[model samples]
Target: MTLPSGKWRLGFDIGGTFTDFVLHEGTTGALTLHKRLTTPQDPSEAALAGLDEILAMQGIGPGDLSEIIHGTTLVTNAVIERTGARTGLIATEGFGDILEMGTEQRYDIYDLFLPFPEPLVPRDLRLEVPERIDASGRVLAGLDEAALERAGAELVGAGCEAVAIAFLHSYANPAHERRAAAILRSAFPDLAVSVSSDVVAGIGEYRRTATAAANAYVQPLMHRYLGRIETALAARGFAGALRLMHSAGGLIPLETARDFPVRLLESGPAGGALATGLFGRAAGLSDMISFDMGGTTAKAALIEDGQAAIAPEIEAARVRRFTRGSGLPIRTPVIEMIEIGAGGGSIAAIDEVGLLKVGPRSAGSDPGPACYGLGGTEPTVTDAALVLGYYDPGFFLGGRMALDAGAARRAVARVADPLGLSVEEAALGIHKVVVENMAAAARVHIVERGRDPRDFAMVGFGGAGPAHAVAVARALGI
Candidate 1:
């Protein structure tokens, strides 16, 4: 966890569409920036590639770096896309359904057909074992070691990569949970285990269980992913400390990050908010708003008196998009912000009402936007921007990659024909809809906090933020 004495420090943020880098020289205070298309298959590949390119630009070797601060959307994307490892949950007897039951509170009370996010672990994988700890930290029913072993065996046989143990009142005693975890690890050496007492250590059953389950879900993935980055860096003679950004806008050691990947749900956004606070203060502004729009999502946060607020909990994979109670709850500290699935690669389409809509779905870096000429045929916000002459087809990515205007037009035509509008008109509609969406969300976020949009300066950053910042600001009357 200690940084070596070196001249350079590196910071990088990995978003859905791109991975961005910042290299700073300690003595000279010079900064170099670089961006690369994110490799969705393995995000570490993009990170390593960008690191090499940036270091090469300055003729500096990896040994020159004293530390590397990384912020990524890995855990967040995995939860949202349901791409994490196959995980099993072990809860107290008759309480195995706590993850599904949630808080039993509706996010939207008026809607009769409201949908809830499905539990990450299916019913078949969530097994109950005989164990109970009373509220006073006393063992009411002794741990059933045999039943625990059987449940672990079943989950391992079912190909589970990780397991979560959440006994009733584990926060009070934690003895049964620790014993169960030790037994499971002894039986399955390769399995990743997360106990509620180690992950959340809280009173609420649903939140504690869900948080532990989430930690287990992403544990194996984070381990493999971090290993790749470390090995790649070490191969190039890097011996510096590697720290990860937490959701609360602070850095944590690599080991802590590995054990609690759920704490990194908003790591990238937290980085943006932190940077916004620093830059806003440098500009002598005490109150400012941060607008960061990347490839897959847009985030807005309010910084008051040079500080970003930290929330006690965060929700993810919301079934109803921005709606509060429609997502999985994870009990972890996070920088408070409003995030929406509206970004450069956000897909554009005609909804059931025949109205043009954008987002919640994205053309990620695998195929990217239609304009990327990377096999994507869907019309996205990036495609619309290119169709509306907002980008130079031949100079995109600084001419390292070229865009296909014709492909963008064809993609936009799909929705245009159905809506009886020209391609250009459809593109404009797409842009306007996205701008309005961001502005509306930002407005709500600001106003709800008893702050007026006009009172704070808006500082926008990110690949797509600058393009739409003015429009969003105008819409907000800021």
Candidate 2:
């Protein structure tokens, strides 16, 4: 199969639940969409398979493909699931506990049960060398080579596959961190090393150190995944250049992504925002809100003047819901979006206090919603939507997965009967509650930035976004 030389665009998005593929003919801008189940074990398998199916259906070959814009959740999954390599941290002596100390702000001030996120590198894996760099970028004490060697030996003994070197004020000077990294690399040639100065050249020691450590934790996984994909693509008789979509809503070369995989942490969400921004432009709307409701989470982003808001830093794997400084901070460029565990597969249940609580937990795609007939016994938001007649069971996923209304009603009854409400009322209540939750999240994220939701038009996408858009908009009094 020869590659096409002109006028064709291929776009693929590997979402949490499904992988969506689009092939557009440049001349007419006609597009075709295909949906496939995402293979979490190896996402590229699904991508390659989907691409083959799309190409065959179009009777086109790889050579006919002009450009392929792709996004994936590989990096995000690595952080959330803690499936990355065993990582060690090297920091200035006496400050090795910065990650544990965090901002010293309690996410749940009144709750004694409030849990803090575990550090990416455990205490034993964390090695502190004798070094001091002040806030003014002055090296108050030089790094001790013997101390670094001892730390390196300990880390190697602790089975660390990667090491993060983050010294106090390294973002400003970086000399100590750089020297420490070189010494570690010299001792452990195969160990992946990430320096805070190279990862995040921003202020805030805790944030910088946490971001660098997170990057180190996920670097080996990302490197292997990307390397495999690149090799597979090259062997497929396609010689075109490959580019990865960044969390900042722009495409960066493969080399850049390889060096800084953290930048792709929110790449999937960024694509949705990009798609929404394009839609807003076509509709001639300037101030817009992009709402994306997928299987695991619902995300909202504010777009003003045709541009999505960008944040210099974002928190990942937070221990508490809607709480700042409760997660590992990642200092990478990303589209500013608020995400909540309020999506199609978010479990709905009654709390011990007799109050209804929606999720910060989800059924995800594996078991999915009970209505999906995929072995999920718990009632989810999608099941609630099904019981409310908001979703057509026959037409879900554009008819890829059939929904079972009977199962949905049964699941809703379990939660609603205990709440002293009828099934229909319970389903509608669940829907309303989730909508308000999403709206409230958007409100907080927007108001914090001194913006109002009323001023922004909503551009909703994802499997559940379009279904819940009007209700959320009404809740916001839009």
The C-alpha local distance difference test score for the whole of candidate 1 amounts to: 0.91
Per-residue alpha-carbon lDDT of model 2 for 1-478, expressed as tens digits?
Answer: 4433666778888877778899998778889889776777878888888888887887886667767788888788788888988999988899889988888887667888878878889988887889887888888999899999899888989899888898888877988888888888898898888989998898898889888888888888878878887787777765666777999999988777776788889998999888788889999998888899987788888888998888998889887767886778888889998884387888999989987778867877777789988788888898999998889999976787798999999999989889899999998888888988888888888899898888889988887888899988898878
Quantify how close model 2 is to the true structure by its C-alpha RMSD in Å. 2.3
The reply for model 1, stretches above 4 Å from the true place, is 1-4
Please name the candidate that would achieve the greatest TM-score relative to the true structure. Answer: 1
| Pairs that collide, model 2 | 2-63, 3-63, 3-64, 4-63, 4-64
Encode model 1's per-residue lDDT on 1-478: one tens digit a residue. 2333777999998899999999998878899988899998999999999999999988888888999999999999999999999999999999999988888888788899989888989999999999888999998899899999999999999999999999998898899999999999999999999989999988999999999999999999999999999899999999889999999988999899888999999999999899899999999998988999999989999999999999989988988888878899999999999884499999998899989999888998879998888899999999999999998989877787888999999999999999999999999999999998888888887888888999888888888888888899898888
In model 2, the runs with Cα more than 4 Å from the true position are 1-6, 107-114, 136-138
Residue 19 in model 1: shift from native, Å?
1.1
**Highest lDDT against the true fold, candidate:** 1
- The deviation in Å at residue 386 for candidate 2 is 2.2
Global CA lDDT of candidate 2, please? 0.84
